[model samples]
Target: MTGPDRRTVTSHLLIAGMSAMIPARSIAATRDPTARTRQGQAKGFVRNGASIFLGLPYGADTGGARRFRPPAPPLPWQGVRDATRPGQRAPQPGIGPLRGPFADYFTGNRSAEIAAMPETLGEDCLVLNVVTPAVDRARRPVLVYIHGGGFTTGTGLVGTLGDRFTVAEDVVLVTVNHRLGALGFMYLGGASPDFADGNPGMLDLVAALRWVRDNIGAFGGDPTNVTLFGESGGGIKVSLLLAMPQAQGLFRRAIIESGLYPDPIAPQVAADQTRDFMARVGASDVAALQRLPFDRFSGAGTPGNLPVADGRTLMARPWAQAPATAANVPLLLGYCKDELTLFALGQPALFDLKWPDVPSRLAAAKLGLPPEAAPGVVDAYRSVFPSDTPSDSYFRISSDASFGRAMVTLADLKSGQRPPVYFYRMDLDTQLPPGLRAMHTAELPLTIGLSPRADADTLTKQISGAWAAFARTGDPNHPGLPQWRPYRPAEREMMVFDQVSSSGPDPQAAPRAMLREAIGSGAQYNPL
Candidate 1:
């Protein structure tokens, strides 16, 4: 689904990088909400009492010569542009039907959600969506979200529509779509001068943030009080953003859900991956690679879109040391209780494992543990949850190895700094199959302020309200929640979200210790 080729507009003033401030005069109310941006004016419609705008260009199309370069500013337009429909998604291989035993359960049979997904996939996907309660100068809080598909698949349209969140919390919600997969992260700096930057996907996000800083004020949002958050891959991106010099001051607060890894792709590893990808596509040079059909790049052996340590854009391991830039920015980090269950659904053998196979099954690559430590890790979890089967224990142990342990380490590292760091564990079980407790993205519906079942309304209000409160200030505490304290090494306090949410010390203490020991030093740990 290649979009129409866009002609390069003569280089105009790039308003996104400018430091000029918009005057705070009261905005006049209009019949149909409209806002004039640096590029041009856009007209949006009111939906369910919120002024909604979709598909506003934040950066120019990354097709042709712009494939692997830093994102360019969007071209100026003559007249008012319509921004009422969803935008194109980044070009990548089709993520065909969800597979495995829990496929239907994973999707929850939500046909409406399946239908709302973006239809267009192309290189011209540097667009974003905005939803605000009003077009007046109310100066509401802004929540800017980056969608998660591990930097390869997915778009802003997937789990973060954010309409309900904006209307309910009176905050402006923005979701952005940027380059993904090889097109976005392929390392070409060592190969040719034409492709010096290998981390364009990360740069695309920086460009989008610059656009938000410049243009969000006109849409009834407080540009100074923006919160940047994402789940999974998006959370990893947030972690990386904390280390980026270009992303400084673009956001005030950050929330990372189920994505906290300490290491980024080494420069040499990224270059090797790029060479391997080029060889797979039979392209020896940048021109030959660009001339091939886009699909050919994603067909087979596509390199993972992990951000690279280019020594410029990203200096070192993202979280190996506390980023000085993020020292003042408050952070919220968490993961679901059973993050690996949804992923394990595709592997039938994992579900059928018996006690004898627990150690072997837990020794998989994602565990990030020594082979000898699997037995001890399994024992630690079994001691915590006595009624567990071998498979259940495997799920919990593997999840901690991948997400929980790393988040704990990160919280510890960040707590040493002055800024507050809050940690959480989502324990809401999916009733679809009953035992799938807080699988990977189970917190999305509630966090994004979507309507939940009758039983979940209170929980939704608690979670979503807390998120809004955090964005409004740096604290996640509100009347709906108990006195939530910042994470500290002595107590390791954390919020647990469920049908009834609560705050306490580490819930699974033994397993956390076991996994931490298995992975050796936290600074050198890598889990993606």
Candidate 2:
């Protein structure tokens, strides 16, 4: 058969196969005929003159023996693997009751958005969702996203839909699922052979990267030009991946939001936490631990949880030790305006501390400050925010100690390597009833340029344009947006995203200085 005829026959077969996988009416209604495949099957839906494909998988079921092991290659099928449905999410313990706004957010309430809930949550949760403008086989820049959950919980399924970014930027967007918490991070070498040393979760991330490098081209993504970006725990994972030897060259650029490696944790303390967990669960062997019921292994206070500084996988404490390997990759790091306010929900007393007493409480918490330094720390904070009340002062100190200082410290270290590092401060106040003002995860909608009203064009072409530019070419500069200068100790230029976004010098200058001094130059501390 001629090449054209062969392509036509192949496309037809693929369309037939995909039709069997999903609803025929939905496909017929939404699929673009003009953007048709060789077999006359639609590959994407037309949105503002661009075609969009949602939820394409990159790996197979990670169940049974595949659990705790590297992601297996997705088995090839005859027809187009329904690239529309999002695969299952990894088993994660739910936090609080799922209702109201939380349920709406998790379920994707947008009328234009497609809901891709996982059929099951188990060890077999290794999968990825892809959003591409077209499937014409032309390699486009790829953005591989990792979701955050304190290295314990969270799935790629939450709060990440590429529809806005994909159509707005005309780029391929990929979000992945990896092992989390104990099942992902537990180091088993000391107890069993199959469950040997190193971080299994990190390994899962590397496996996903490898899968992207190998197969992204099939979905119109440039494997060599992938960028890894994440928020919170996901940001921390990106930091770890930068230090990991296995992740080298898989991704070219990175964007970390609200989390940094330099946030100190005592290695021994983490190990002890693991030991206590193992002891509590009554599992001395790795096999037995693996065999534990999923429910028993999940949730808070579980054994063999959280990423450990196992010397091999985690070369050194991320915050204390400079990431020599990732030094060359361009980085973008930042935090929200009122980062600590979210913690007040769980620890109400956090909001009660007086400004002068903030430093003392933090020092006592073993946040790298000496006991005697508490008074001076408080004084320094007061001097910085002289007009602020005790509550404001306390929140500033806590936010800096936990996230802000660490972000700056990492950026400072990376800046020394001569790599372009961009910084930002998200100050937009959503004013949601929860009273979270620019809190963690708040910048997500802005980053993706999503708005509440379907008819409203709140999609700022500038933000999405910059992100697309960055994904396309390692730089976020675009038309109508101010030139984003690389972060430096001297200038400390930060891109502020708010009701009005712009690039400028440090806005929280005094507070930032006090944090740097209190945390020391490296912001390093032994985890208690």
Count of steric clashes across candidates, in order:
0, 8
Off by over 4 Å in 2: 1-29, 32-60, 95-119, 262-284, 318-321, 346-390, 452-462, 521-528
TM-score of each: 0.88, 0.81
Query: For residue 172, what is the lDDT in candidate 1?
Result: 92
Q: Candidate 1: where is the Cα deviation over 4 Å? A: 1-32, 96-117, 364-366, 433-435, 522-528
Error of 2 at 223 (Å): 1.6
Question: What digit string (tens of lDDT, one per residue) describes model 2 on residues 391-480?
Answer: 666666666676777788788888887578888877665453344455656565455555432321233455557667877887888875
How accurate locally, in lDDT, is each candidate?
A: 0.73, 0.62
Question: Which ten-residue region of model 1 has the weakest summed lDDT?
Answer: 9-18
Model 1 over residues 275-294: C-alpha lDDT tens digits? 88777778889888778776
Total clashes in model 2, counting residue pairs 3 or more apart in sequence or in different chains: 8
Task: Extract clashing residue pairs from model 2.
Answer: 11-39, 12-39, 62-124, 261-319, 262-319, 265-527, 266-527, 355-390
